[model samples]
Target: MGTWSARPFGNDSAADWAYELDEASDWGVVSDALRVAAEAVPSDLDSDDAVTAIAAAEVVARGLGRVPESAGSVDAFVARVSAPPPEMVALAVSALAVAASAEGELADLWEGDPEWLAENEKLRSALTTE
Candidate 1:
């Protein structure tokens, strides 16, 4: 996982995903990642997928005008890309739910960590709120 913190983009997988996002010419990168995670059965979702999904959701959150303070590369990606379609916000919300579910590796990895859980909840709140 190579995690240094509980922030959405605080892991190696998410940092890699952020690089992909930065290089993308459109929002499809975010949409594809969110769709894959949103559609997967929680038990079948791996840690990398979960991490990427969370990072993608953070992008969607930014599109919805809720940028997190620690959005490193994501801030640049957002500035370069147009805001995602409204539907993507819904997908992001769903992806976040699945990624944080009890059956997923991400949840397992952060199981006993209050900071991780709070960070996940914070992302979720960002996506769902106006």
Candidate 2:
């Protein structure tokens, strides 16, 4: 099996991504991430993001397909989209976990991070229902 890093997409730090240069510095990927953040998407007809964070997840998953193997790099994708769905946030988490699991990185990220791991676990559990 291949060795993977313990990095949840949003868990990425500064050095994890410095390739974009222009957007990588100012936006720092976080802003781009917010583009698909659960709290960022609009839920209502007026494009209201105040409804639920899950809304962002919906869009994220729809557009990004599945979370890539590196959650750290999601910001790169998020930066491009001006507005993403609410469920995208959840999509981000699920896809990132799938990516991690495939790459063997999930074990590392879940280690010692009970809260984060717990959230991931919950997301994993929810998959069965979906």
Candidate 3:
């Protein structure tokens, strides 16, 4: 991924018919946007679908640099990300938390997640399958 800068969002995150993401000035709006955007998406960060949400939040947060470390070091990464504009941080955290919630996987499964996002786990395995 190219850094998660303040650069405009891509087709992956904001669809052609979706509402304008930046126009969201509060939680209700943000939640609405994410709901519309992630409607069919089965999972988060572990899923490209989820990463798309994280990236959308990053566009608003302007903390794209954290992408490199989000996986390797979550605490340091969240701390750095927590320092951004409040609206940005809150939105980012909300989106990420929702992403995590959607999948129900706190960390790597290292195996199948039969109860949570089995589809996401399947996709993840497919991504690195040998």
Give candidate 3's whole-model lDDT: 0.38
Q: Can you tell me which runs of candidate 2 are displaced by over 4 Å?
A: 1-15, 18-81, 85-94, 100-103, 119-130
Q: Tens digit of lDDT per residue, candidate 1, span 1-130? A: 7999888888999988887866777889998999888999999999899999998998888776786454666777788788877788889999999988888888888876899888889899988777
Candidate 2 per-residue C-alpha lDDT over 7-42 given as tens digits, one digit per residue, 9 for 90 to 100: 222322322332332344232243243343322212
Highest lDDT scorer: 1
Candidate 3, TM-score vs. the true structure? 0.30
Alpha carbon lDDT of each predicted model: 0.85, 0.35, 0.38
Task: Kindly give the stretch of ten consecutive residues in candidate 3 with the minimal lDDT sum.
Answer: 66-75
Residue 95's lDDT within candidate 2 is 40
| lDDT of candidate 3 at residue 117, scale 0 to 100 | 46
Of candidates 3 and 2, the better by lDDT:
3
TM-score of 1: 0.93
Q: What digit string (tens of lDDT, one per residue) describes model 3 on residues 1-130? A: 3323221232344332124433433334334444433453334334434445544454333332432322222223334333334554455455555554544333243123353345334323322233
User: What is the overall TM-score of model 2 with all chains considered together?
Assistant: 0.28
Q: Using lDDT as the measure, what is the rank order of every candidate, best first? A: 1, 3, 2
TM-score list, all predictions: 0.93, 0.28, 0.30
| Cα RMSD to the true fold for all candidates | 1.3, 13.8, 12.0
